[model samples]
Target: MIAKIMGVLNVTPDSFSDGGQHFDIADAIQKAQCLIDQGADIIDIGGESTRPDAKPVSFKDELVRVIPVIKTLAETTDVPISIDTSKPEVMLQAVESGASMINDVCALRVNGALETASELGVDVCLMHMQGVPKNMQLSPVYDEVIEDIKHFFAGRIEACISAGISESKLILDPGFGFGKTYEHNLEILRCFDEFKSFGLPLLAGMSRKTMIGQMLGDRDVSTRVTGSVAGAIIAVQNGADIVRVHDVEETKDGLMVLGSVS
Candidate 1:
């Protein structure tokens, strides 16, 4: 099957790539609609930045940032909505406000998150981050990156199952840049298909990330589109079921060419 495209909609003022650009509710809605028009299969709305060394926003603030956009988008579009948050309260309210999926960088490890996700009964994308955003990139070490991530996924899958969440309702993300050095990110993409052993959908989100920038000789975020699209295509060719990206149109174009040839 062709890989699905998940458009990123960050409503925070400090998101790495497109912050402040969509902080206004009106702009956020406009951007969401634009992504839908650009062939996005899902819209992943995030309030918190989650960029390295980023400060956390309170759940109250997060709700205020995302709920209205979620509500409006739910009412306006048929595309699925995914809330990018780990707060149980935000998850609960966002679902009530019409979010159908939870994309948690914390992978439901936050207190009450597993229980809340189970109760909500929505699709959850459990991402592997070596550490919290504030300090994750300071220095990330893994005995063996792929094996270590697999181990983490195993434990989290068990935790979700124990919390009454169905195995089918889960998706996995290797967390491309969350806590990885350039080499780790490359290895993950090179051996991405290994993750498919879990029998769950895999998401690859490396759009305009530091790794892409680094590979392109320290290109600025705005100049990383080509590299980001290349990464998305590689991930899709390997095993990515969904690619979370800021440049939805470009990624979709690349995937179309890939689908036609492959």
Candidate 2:
């Protein structure tokens, strides 16, 4: 099957990429529509910036940032909406406002999050971050990256099941760049398929990330689109079921060519 493209919409002023680009309600709605028109299969909206060294937003602030956009899109479009947050309150509100999925960097490890996700009954993407965003990159260490992530997923999956979440509702993400060094990120991509051992859909999100920048001789974020597309294609080739990306149209075009050749 062709990998689905999940478009990123950050409604924050300090995101690593495109921050302040869609902080307004109208602007956020417009961006979501643009992503839909660009062939995005899923629209993942985030009110908080989980970028390294990023400060946290209060629950009220995050809700104010994302709910109006989600409500408007739910009323305007038929596209699936995914809330990119780990806060249980935000997850509950987003789903109520029309988000059909939860993309949590913390993998529902936050207090009350696992219970909230289980109750919401929406698809959940559990990402593996070695540590919190504020200091995750300081010195990320794992005996074996791939095996360690797999082990993490196994424990999270069990916890989700124990919390009354269906196994089928779970999606796995290796949390590229969240706490990984450049070498760690590359190693994850090289062995990304190993994540499929869980028998669940795998999501690969490496769009305009530092890894791509480092691979391209430390290119700036704006110039890393081509490299990001290449990473998406490679992930798909290695069995990624979905790719979370910022450049939806470019990734779609790359996937089209890949599909034709394969």
Worst 10 residues of 2 by lDDT: 1-10
lDDT on C-alpha atoms for all candidate structures: 0.97, 0.96
Note the clash tally of each candidate.
0, 0
Residue-by-residue lDDT tens digits, candidate 2, 83-176: 9999999999999999999999999999999999999999999999988999999999999999999999999999999999999999999999
Model 1's TM-score against the true structure: 0.99
Superposed model 1: Cα runs more than 4 Å off: none
lDDT of 1 by residue, 1-262 (tens): 3999999999999999998999999999999999999999999999999999999999999999999999999999999999999999999999999999999999999999999999999999999999899999999999999999999999999999999999999999999988999999999999999999999999999999999999999999999999999999999999999999999999999999999999
Where is model 2 more than 4 Å wrong at Cα? Answer: none
lDDT winner among the candidates? 1
- Give all candidate RMSDs, comma-separated: 0.6, 0.6
